[model samples]
Target: MKPGADRIELRGLKVRGYHGVFDFERRTGQDFVIDAVLELDLRPAAASDDVNDTVHYGELAERLAAVVSGEPVNLIETLAARLAEVCLADARVAAATVTVHKPQAPIPLEFADVAVVVRRTREESA
Candidate 1:
């Protein structure tokens, strides 16, 4: 971890998207729950008490939602990766972990949910 490294988390951000192998899934979009954890230095924000010193989570949420609602993908893994990219777009974010939940997955049996989690560093995203 870098100096003053702390975590900023956004959890349970739900958006409707068309991301799945099945044609029906794409035709009728489903909800995807997203969780993102960002690792970065928070001391600047703490000291200055300025929003500019830290990551603006509300804007981040909007960006992530746009990704989820925009293009269609065949896998949640791709979606998670895309979300990681969005999180790492900020230079302040050293690393990020993104999880995408597919609650209405096509399964033969009953299950709680299906999700994919991806972790990436700023370098990797770049």
Candidate 2:
């Protein structure tokens, strides 16, 4: 978003999914955390005071969870991309920033988390 553009932020959305490379990781689903920042113009919603004028965040969350719990991808990057697609499907959204976190990643050493961030903006067709 630009310096003054309106935005909607969704954070710490956790879902269970089977998205990983290892066989064990796929067989046993793991917890995945997602964060999203949706950039858009909220003036319409603000003035109209109508839910339809703005993106419904509850529905958005459900759609994002469906993507995470749907197909199995080997990379969180791919998962993040799919999530961004869902976010950008709304024509009103100017940009979508998606972050996928994997806390229980199979690493030999102690690590806090592994995550992938993806940002996508609407493409204006001429």
Candidate 3:
């Protein structure tokens, strides 16, 4: 059960929070959808069925919400990077892909939303 042997997906996690540059944008936040895929080894957790043996997806979602909603960020890239960092912090999660969607982006033209995606892996040098 070495690292980077398992995968977990957290898809379409809808979070409403303040994240923008404009004053109005921060005042009246918008909905942000987050999708994440984590690579880890789940053999230990599988054998014991213990939460401690694996990464808790629910906790990961909450941490992402705190980051996305806690403060305002000018770009989704920053947000996505922050999320990637969070995922990599967990030793079990060898790598992660994070996507942040801003369905309420301000624009004159018609569109569904703007989004950013980032993939990160734990570095051996780190």
Candidate 4:
């Protein structure tokens, strides 16, 4: 299997975090929704039917949640970048795309959500 030919996706990972440009946002905190797509070759796992041959998405989810809950950042862009880094931490993941959604952003008008998306590869991450 070639790299980037297969994908494992985790969507709608919601965690409360203190990340925003405003002081009140940081103090009060809000729900941050995360979505991640990890690109890699999954043939080995498919053939062997072993968890070790592929990324364990459940474990990855937990790790991502930890990141969202851990540090306080100023921008969803930074948060997205951090999540991409976490996704790429697994050597088997050739690339990762991370999206961070802020539903309660301090916008004056009505909006569904504000978000940032970032894509990173192992080489770029290095």
TM-score of each: 0.95, 0.94, 0.88, 0.96
Q: Give the candidates in order of TM-score, highest first.
A: 4, 1, 2, 3
Better of 1 and 2 by TM-score: 1
lDDT of 1 by residue, 1-106 (tens): 5822699999999999999999999999999999999999898999999999999999999999999999999999999999999999999999999999999999
lDDT of 3 by residue, 92-113 (tens): 7888889999888887799977
Task: Report how far off residue 88 is in candidate 1 (Å).
Answer: 0.4
Question: Clashes in model 3: which pairs?
Answer: 6-40
In model 2, which runs have C-alpha deviations exceeding 4 angstroms? 1-4, 124-126
Between prediction 1 and prediction 3, the one with superior TM-score is 1
Clashes of 3: 1
lDDT of 1 at 68: 99
* Alpha-carbon lDDT, every model: 0.94, 0.91, 0.86, 0.94
On a 0 to 100 scale, what is the lDDT of residue 109 in model 4? 100
By summed lDDT, the worst window of 10 consecutive residues in model 3 runs over 117-126
After superposition, candidate 3 runs with Cα above 4 Å error: 1-5
Misplaced by over 4 Å in model 4 are: none
